[model samples]
Target: MPTYRTTAVDAVHNDEELRLNLDLLEGRRERAAIREAKAKLQMTKYYNARVRGVTFSPGDFVYRSNDASHDVAGGKLGPKWEGPYEVTEALGDGAYRLRSMDGTILPRT
Candidate 1:
């Protein structure tokens, strides 16, 4: 009971093609929306953290690292953290000198 020429095409070609395309596009859109939501949620959580990272300047006193594992000259193998060392001068980034216990100051970098 054929009423149209469908010998070389699908019997319901137009309707089926449109439906398949729509289904595929809808799946893509939903995936994109879900990805956006996840990214936003992650960013919000990251921004909400009360991150505390501060630095000090020259002539400030800071607790010297007391790690006993940093000794090339057996420096850290003694105390956990020694001095509330007076940061005599900052050499630029993170290097500093302590006003020595015997008054012989030198940069400890």
Candidate 2:
């Protein structure tokens, strides 16, 4: 009867192969991260370039849209805009505290 060996003798080569595979994966991860960062920067730049800022000041005459309560007379077919309200105060970020032409404070939307 003859005995056959069934064990690997190249343990060093296996270790080297594993180390190389790990290094390759690490490099791929670094490259992917860099690409993602560049793409985010491009998106930010594009949006900033195209975005327009709107500002409102006190005492500005602006129109107000009719609310749901206004639909009693006109219903869906009624007028959409109702006001030439005056801006009493600039609340920043395009918001304003408004007053009616009669000087009555309107509710904030």
Candidate 3:
């Protein structure tokens, strides 16, 4: 049986034929990259269309996730949210400085 290598050797008769095949392969790769980029943009648009932007201003009360606070001791039954912490500063891109009820600023945002 003629394997892939033998078939390829039979298909390309000369260096010119090999160069033609390489050019076709390069065109195929460029087209594939364009298709991939279009697919990514389509997926991004579909996802962003469904996304709702929630912006928090300074002094707004927000709840922190227990998982964010690294409170692993609570296990299954513990409260999912840790805080009614006050947002002290809006640090752009949904990050904020939080202050506990007692007025101590959290070390991390």
Candidate 4:
């Protein structure tokens, strides 16, 4: 008669098998990390290629979005942009200090 053995009983309980399993797990983790990094690099490259770099210099006129402005009204029918605000200063990395046409410097960037 043949005897049936449970997985726990049939499994190799040797140090060599344990070491091999550990090495395999470590290899899988390393490959996964490399794959993740490559995916991130590819995504970054795609994004950079499609993205338009916009930089405002000091004294340039630009319109601001009305969504966060206090004077916005009329719901969806309202004007989507405000200001032909003057760029007072370029704070770098696309940030700027803006001044309204009335010459008031905006408190926030």
- RMSD in angstroms, all models? 8.8, 7.0, 3.5, 3.4
Question: Poorest 10 consecutive residues of model 1 by lDDT?
Answer: 67-76
lDDT of 4 at 74: 69
lDDT tens per residue, model 1, 1-109: 6555745566587789989998899889999999999999999889878665556676677776655325334544556666666767766655666675556674445
- Ten consecutive residues with minimal summed lDDT in candidate 3? 6-15
Which residue pairs collide, candidate 4? none
Q: Comparing candidate 1 with candidate 3, which one achieves the higher lDDT?
A: 3
TM per candidate comes to: 0.38, 0.53, 0.79, 0.75
Off by over 4 Å in 4: 1-19, 73-77
lDDT of 2 by residue, 12-79 (tens): 98889999999899899999999999999999999999999866688789876777236336777888
Model 4 lDDT tens row, 1-109? 5545543453556667888899899889999999999999999999999999889888899999877675678687888989899999998877789999999998873
- What root-mean-square deviation over C-alphas does model 4 reach? 3.4
Error of 1 at 13 (Å): 23
All models: lDDT?
A: 0.69, 0.81, 0.88, 0.85
Model 3 lDDT, residue 106, Cα: 87
